[model samples]
Target chain A: MILTVTPNPALDLTWHVEALSPGATHRVPTAAARAGGKGLNVARVLHGAGHEVLALATTGGATGAEFTAELAASGVPHRLLAVRAPTRRSAAIVDDRRGETVVLNELGGPLAAEESTALHDSAVQLARDAGVVAICGSLPPGFGAEHLGELVAAIAASGVPVVADTSGPALLAAARAGAHVVKPNREELEQATGRAEPLAGARALLDLGAHLIVVSLGTEGLLVVGRSGAPVHARLPEPLHGNATGAGDAAVAAIAAALATGVDLAADTDAAARARLDLARRATAWSASAVLMPLAGELSPRHAELEAAVVATPIHEESR
Target chain B: MILTVTPNPALDLTWHVEALSPGATHRVPTAAARAGGKGLNVARVLHGAGHEVLALATTGGATGAEFTAELAASGVPHRLLAVRAPTRRSAAIVDDRRGETVVLNELGGPLAAEESTALHDSAVQLARDAGVVAICGSLPPGFGAEHLGELVAAIAASGVPVVADTSGPALLAAARAGAHVVKPNREELEQATGRAEPLAGARALLDLGAHLIVVSLGTEGLLVVGRSGAPVHARLPEPLHGNATGAGDAAVAAIAAALATGVDLAADTDAAARARLDLARRATAWSASAVLMPLAGELSPRHAELEAAVVATPIHEESR
Candidate 1:
């Protein structure tokens, strides 16, 4: 089973309005709420594709209860550690008239030291039994980069490959902790490494000890790079136009699913290179397929056709 | 004792951000949630003033639990009847940079038939013990104007004065059911009676059997009209510039508090006229004082000073 950990999960609330005016009052007839976080989204995508997956997160208060209840109702297997502070909420106001969404995310409240330690211990224990583990999303307040580094190191030491999808110092922490793979979108890569070019940013992570780096380039698809191999750039012929909120999580799910299938990436051989290329192609296709779906946790059923349409080409190291 | 009924109560959530831009993601460091509704605000105002008050409303689901928990934490005496659907939420996004707030209100989900009957029965029974009963805010989905009318009629028949603060057809229904007083803001009055002028709109409610029509005119203060004699206009010498969100509810609280003290308005005598004027002056002052406060359900401590500054003048019927 694939294990996913979201340090700061949220109860996502979405409201659709005809138009969004800066200072006007709006009446929303109905609203939708569900459990959300990058790691949870990764688990959902894998589960929807008939893969065995388990989502782990910290929750508290009434909002946390609602979040856990929604996950149970959705039938996604999950184990949540109780914390002291209430789970934060991320409200997305979708403007029907403007065809765009504005999101207001609450930075989660501080987690107690004991709560953080409990989560770290739980993630390590769960990772031992899982085929692959993915640590995702932003860390909650008081959950420092050192904590993320220690958790990733413990999970990686458990003999299971750990993948991390986070931003800022946490991204570097996961990489330095020897995560097998790390995924960060274009903007996040820049924010973490201060590198405008994806290749340079991927190199920075590789220099920190990450085995492989997968960068999601939005409509441009995925870029896969390693410490010493020809980087692969995978993209579909035409960009798909739809919601892109869950694309990176879908990419992470694809990478985790591929790694769980016993692909040996430690050896320097032609077979290993081909396996890495195949992984890159699958991730790009899955990420693109996610754009066609409306909600974050959902994936389009046309993933096979999308996989076939992806073009993976090796790029010269000196290009950037 | 005063009873305040909020048919469609909300868990009010407020978030502050630097600025609101369409299609942009914002990070809210913290957020605040509390029990809110027109009637609940009225009850809060009364309770804050050291008056005996009970707030009543229907609640369901986890959000409802949070609402009740917050009220309990605040030490507000309340009774919440359980319903099937979750209580609605009103989110206010305060733009710190722009110095404005945008509100997104969710109209509550449909209430079960049995739940509606239970609320109706409970409100009427509670009204019997209350010195003054105030029915406030909008009715939930499936709880029609007819339900409001029936509830008001039953409460009025119990010999307790009923004050209603609602808009649209519900206001007319409350008036026709012999509500002792009705408070509607300027825009609500125009929408209900299709009269741009408050005098004409107040006259329409009077013709429908309402004993008093109190129109909240925002910065301009209040216009109080009865079925006979001269209408009274009351205003503070200077407008208090602050949040006016809970101003109308504070006015209703003042009117209810005044009536609870055994001010008889049944006779068209000189004493009754003076009592009506006093009620108008108090309502105006209390409302202005509420504007000076930051949050809803809060009143400024300068209410007494505001009351002394209020000017109540008899308006000639021929002037309309």
Candidate 2:
């Protein structure tokens, strides 16, 4: 079983309007809702791929109840830890006429110290026997960078590979814990390393102890760097553009699924190198496929075909 | 006690974003939520003014639960009728830097015919001893324009003057029912009568048997037209510029309060004519005061001062 932990999650509300005019009232013909959060998005994608997944999240208040209801409706298996603060809500407005979309997100209220500790314990305990454990999303209140590192350490000690998809101090914590794989988008990478060059920032993350680091470059694609191998850049031959909201999460899900399905990660062996290349292709394809979907946490069936369309190019050490 | 009925109510979610960029993820620093709808706004304003108020709304699902929770927290007495579909949620993204706000609203799902009938019955029963009964906002699903007319007739039969704050076919229905007071904005009046001239449209509504018609003209203030008196233009000497959301609702609430407290509505008589002018000045002051607030359904204490600053100009019949 694959274990997914979302420290902070939200209910995503989406509305469509003819056009968006600032300081004006808009009539939305309809609105759609879904269970949302960085980790929840990954969990949904993994579950959709027919994997046996267990999602762990903290929920409370009326909004939290509603969020859990939506999660139940989404058919993802989950263990909810009740808390005092309501889960946050996120909204997106699509101006169909202008083809523009605006997203608004709320930072969930502070989590009690006891509840925060309970969440860490739950995540660690749930990781047992799971081939892959993916801890994703923002750190909730009462959780510092050390909290993320501690969770990673506990999970990693169980012999299960831990993948972390987060940003800022949390990403630094996961890297320090030497997470098996760390995914950081371009902006996050820059922010974490304070480096202008994506490769320089990615290298800094690798040096910080992450076994492998995948730096997402938005429409540009992924830069995969390992502690002991030539870095590679992976992308589709042509950019397949759609909604990019959950593309990064899709990549995280693909990597976690790959680890669960027996893809070797040791970069020293020739077979391991092949496994890494194969993993890169799959991650690129999954990320690309996510764009074809209108909502996050969803993947298109054409991902298999897209996998074949991905091309990974070796980046010389001198390029950095 | 002031009684307000909102057939279609929603949870208003307001997000504060540094800026809005189409198709980009925005991190909302904070989000404020409140009970929202025309009647609810007026109810809140009335309640805020220390008036005994009861707000009646239909609610269901998670969003509705949140809406009711917020209403309870607001200290407004409310009765929520259970429905099948989840309550709708509206979102507003304020771009502070640009001084602009974009709103997106979802029309709640259609109400079942039986559910609609139950709502009407509930409103009529609740109006038994209410000093003023205000039927406000859009007609929810399963309700035709005729449904509004039926509701007005029922409420009016209970010896209570029904104040309708609505537009379009519902306004037409209310007029045909001879609602004691019907509040329509300039745009609504124009749309309902297909007349560009506000006076002409006001006359048409008055001819439809409305006892009084107050046409809101935004910053231009109000145009009050009764069955007998010539139309009067009322305004604050200087427009109070602020967020205009819910300002109209405040005006409606003030007018309702004025009537309930004993402002004569016999427009054909000279004494009643003087009462109408007094009511217009008070209503315009309340509307103007609402604009000074950051939140809908709230007003600053400066309403009294603004009331003394209002000027009402008599419009001769020849203009119509």
Candidate 3:
């Protein structure tokens, strides 16, 4: 089983309108609301793929109740911790005429000290029997990067591999805490390491004690790097276009699914190298498949065909 | 006591941002949520002025919980009927850089047949002891204009005068049901009566069995017509420029407040004419004062000064 922790979750609302006009009143013809956050998306992808996964997050207030009810309706296995502050909401307005989407995200309120401590303790305990743990999303107010570092260290100490999917200072903290794998998209990697080159950014995470660094390059595909051996790259023959909001989360789900088999990449053997290549191919295909779906936390049924079309290669020489 | 009924109440959320760029994601720095609807705003204005008032509306689902909690915190006396459908929400994005506001309103879900019947029965019973009753706002899905007409007729049957502030066909429905006073903005009046002139529109409403017709003309002040006597016109010495969203509701509040004194305009006596002039002056002043307020359900403290600046006159000749 895999355990997923979402520090900040949202009741995501989407409104469909004819078109968007700034400073004008719009009557939405259709609207939908669901439970959303990076970790929850990851858990949903895994669960849909017939994997056993448990989603953990903190919920409170009226919006929190709505979020919990939505998650339950989705039939996703989950446990929620109660807090005092109301959950934040994110709204997206999809304009059909112009084919544009405008989003508004609320900054979540501060978490109590005890609530943060309780979340950390709960996550560590839940990871005891899991083969791998995935910690995803932004750090909420009052939750410093150091808290994420401590949680990552504690979960890794329990002999379960931890995958950190975050950005900025939190990404560095997770790497320094000895997380087994860290995934950062191209823009996030640049923001965290201040390095325009993806390889240089991946090397920065490796130097911080991370066993593997996977960088998502959008249409360019996936790049995997480690302390030893040449970095691997994977991509499909053509680019797919649809909704790209959940592509990264689906990629992270593929990585977690691969690691749940108790495969140890630190062994540096032929089997480890082959497993790394498989992870890259699967991640690229899953991400592309997600782009074909209209909403997040869903994948196209042609994932196997997409994986078969992927071409993964090892970079023995430096390349841009 | 005055009773206000809002058939389609909303939990209004406001988000403040520096600027708005279509198709871009905005991180709202500040946000606020409160219970809002036309009738509720009227009740709030009356309550703020030390008048005994009760607000009645329907609430359900998560958004309803938040609305109920906020109404409780506001200290406004209210009784809400629960339904299966979630309450609707309206969001406004205030862009400081552009000095503009963008609004998105959700059409409330359908009310169950039993729920609608229950609300009508409850309102009629509650209005039994009220000096005047005010019905405001749009009809929710599954609720037709005939329902509003019936509700108004039922409340008025209990000997409580009904002041209706609504739009479209609902405005005509209320007038046809013998509403004591019906207030509609110039645009709404034109839409409901299919008349280009405000006086003609007011006459149309009066022909439908309404006792009084008050048409708000934005910066042009108000045009009031009734079953007897010449039409009255009221305006401030100078037009005040500010938020005008709640100005009409404030006008309705003033009318309800004046009627709560048990003054009978149907008597057609000299004292009754004097009371109509007073009502016109107060309504114009209160409506202008509301323009200075940033949010609905609030009146400026300078209402007395504004009232002193109003000039009201009776029109004996036909005018546009």
Best by DockQ: 2
Tens digits of per-residue lDDT for model 3, A1-320: 99999998877777777877876677764357788888999999999999999999999888899999999999999989999988888777767677556777787877899999999999999999789999998878877789999999999987899999999999999999999999999999999999999999999998997899999988888998877777899999898765567789999999999899889865588888888889899999999998777667888999999999999999897554
Give lDDT: candidate 2, residue B292: 78
Please identify model 1 stretches exceeding 4 Å from their true place: A219-222, A230-244, A264-281, A305-314, A317-320, B229-244, B264-285, B288-294, B302-319
Pairs that clash in candidate 3: none
Q: Which candidate do you rate higher for TM-score, 1 or 3?
A: 1
Candidate 3 regions exceeding 4 Å error are A29-31, A196-199, A216-244, A263-285, A288-294, A302-320, B29-31, B196-199, B217-247, B263-294, B302-320
lDDT (10s digit) by residue, model 2, range A131-176: 8999998887887789999999888877888999999989999999
Deviation from native of the Cα of residue A166 in model 2, angstroms: 1.0
Winning model by lDDT: 1
| Candidate 3 lDDT over residue span B137-212, tens digit each | 8889867799999999988777799999999999999999999999999989999999988989999998998889
Clashes counted in candidate 3 amount to 0
What does candidate 2's lDDT look like per residue over B60-118, in tens digits? Answer: 88788889889888888898899987788777677766756677778788889789988
Instruction: Output DockQ, candidate 2.
Output: 0.72
Provide fnat values for all models in the order shown.
0.90, 0.88, 0.73
